[model samples]
Target: MASSALQVFGFTLGVLAWVGMIGTCASPEWRKNSHGQTLIDNTLKYEGLWVSCTAFVTGQTNCKDYAEFFVNLPQVLQICRALMISSIGTGFVAIIITVLGMKCVGLGSSNHIVKARIALLGGLLFGISGVLTGAAVSYYAQGVLQDYYNPSFAQGLTNVP
Candidate 1:
């Protein structure tokens, strides 16, 4: 009974993780920059895998989707996009497999050993998805940091005098 309860808990957590991953991937505020109240204006900027947006203090926001051509995007953006998409895909597969393997689910073979192996494989896929997500976020953050510290980069509104 205790093992069944644990399995349920684990399955719940896995589903929540998958949902969180989707939210993170879809959010437009992955990276944010705020310009202090300058004489000209105060604005907030956000950049994400799919779009860039600006918010004005007057409660107005404007967003623009990325170019249709993937090749035109920066290398870091390209790699991160691929990794995040792959992670989502893997997580989806993991969810299906986990449901089949769960102790409470009767969709698959009744053999205990086979079910255990399937559960293990599902767990492994979840781990792989997590690793992919981490790599993508870390790589993107590294690129952002490198550009932020480089005086010569001269990109983004943050560099405005």
Candidate 2:
């Protein structure tokens, strides 16, 4: 009925969100600004949680892991890395709880109220994880914006987006 359908829908959405969280955490384009655009000497660069990479149009790529220069990294990036990983853990917990609480599942069949409570708890956890993810992204984005608008950063830029 309606309850079962809604539960299925929520679970499906949760799965999608989990995938998206993983992508966001792993993406190297969280903050990027590239320069040059020719097949021979083009330079493409991007920064991620763990490393920063620069690629040449000749198919050469060089990456420097953050751990090597961890002390020099901005505070926001450090916080972002921690939050993203924690959010993934929270999302996993939510999915497990929701699946067990589903009506079609046999894990928690003692009482309807108990199952419902578990499902509600899962939903709440999803909300919490979402908030944490949002905060992390926003914090990093703000830093990027600040850097983009700063005079010192603009002084050496050539065609940035």
Note the Cα lDDT for every prediction shown: 0.82, 0.82
Q: What TM-score would you give candidate 2 relative to the actual structure?
A: 0.85
Q: Kindly provide the TM-score of model 1 when superposed on the true structure, using C-alpha atoms.
A: 0.90
Tens digit of per-residue lDDT, candidate 1, span 17-95 = 8888888888887787757779334788888888888888888999999875468787877888899999999999999
Per-residue lDDT tens digits for candidate 2, residues 41-102, read 36778888877888877778998777643466678777898899989999999999988888
- Models 1 onward score TM values of 0.90, 0.85
Residue 42 local lDDT, model 1 = 79
Which residue pairs show backbone clashes in model 2? none
| Top TM-score prediction, candidate number | 1
Q: In model 2, what is the error at residue 145, expressed in angstroms? A: 0.2
Which residue segments of model 2 deviate by more than 4 Å? 35-41, 68-72, 156-161
